[model samples]
Target: MRFLGNFLTNSSRRHAAAILSAAAFAGASSIGFAAPALAHDAVLSSQPEQNETIKQLPHEIILNFSGEPQQGFNTISVSRDGNVLFRGEPRAKGQELILDVPDNVRSEPGEYTVGYQITSSDGHATRGGYQFTVDNPDSSAAAEGSDDAKADTTATSTEGEQGESNSSVPSWLLPVGGIVVIAGALVLAIKRYRDIKKD
Candidate 1:
């Protein structure tokens, strides 16, 4: 009876130790996951200053983020009212996404909204917008030049739409699909073999 009691106590201690070790491991994993979440990319700065008015128009709208953007998923759009002013492929330099402004932008001076969507290197997407105004009072006199700018903006928007329509499956999807098909075929083959043996 004494030996039996000693064995039971030792077993309980071992079980408790395993549980404590598992809890510690889980705590460490939680911290590891949280570190990345806390370090997600965010807007660090923007050109033209949000809500600021400028006397001279900027050549481009620049956005700086806290981290590098995921390639092929970063986008920036500049619009005046509901009409797209500039839209095309976004260029990334370091942690910044740049949208090259068309020269005709100087012809129309009013409030413009710059919208940005960036997918971080970690596969998380972030989006935000800011507004800036051009304080050019003689914008009406620049209407002739504005027509060319408007046409350019329209072309850019059309190109953006076309690019979006060209859809190819993600690179990872092909391998995943092949693996699933192979697994299904194997399972079916095994079942058929088992039936034949049984028959």
Candidate 2:
């Protein structure tokens, strides 16, 4: 009877220790789960300095974020007088997004809107816009006329270089090269086998 009582006490103590340990582990895990949720807020900072006026228009617009975005889901739109001006693909650079603007954006002094939507790593989405204006319309017009010719020339030269580089490689050469190497190896193996058989 004494042995039975001692056994029961020891078993109860062991069960109690296990329950306490499980509770402690669960409490620790619960604390860890709250961390990611707290860090998931979407934040955005954009260039052209919200409401800034510049003499020269920027070739590229940039937006820096607090978190990495979901690929293929982020979008940026620039407009002047409610007409969409730039709607191109955005490239991600670390936590920043760089968008290439159209080369022919009207440099005339007027209010423009830059709108953006970004989805954060934790799936939270954020959206916002800011306005900026060009102060000198005539200056922009003259700059545009001068820049138009230069931009076209630069684009043409770049395209020509790319085309030349691509034309240097014949599409059929890759397969032909592979086949030649395989045939040479097969011929060498056949000769070696014949030599071995003769020996």
TM-score per model over all chains: 0.61, 0.50
* Candidate 2, 1-199: lDDT as tens digits: 9999999999999999999999999999998987776665343677787888876568888887788777777888998879888876589887887898787776666788888887777776767778887687678677889899999999999999999998989889999999999999999999999999999
- Residue 158's C-alpha lDDT in candidate 1? 96
lDDT for 192 (candidate 1): 100
Best by lDDT: 1
Query: Compared with the true structure, what per-residue lDDT tens digits does model 1 show for residues 28-56?
Result: 99999988867768887889789998876
TM-score of 2: 0.50
Candidate 2 overall lDDT versus native: 0.82
Clash pairs, model 2 backbone: none
- Candidate 2 Cα misplacement greater than 4 A, ranges: 1-44, 137-199
Report clashes for each candidate as comma-separated counts. Answer: 0, 0
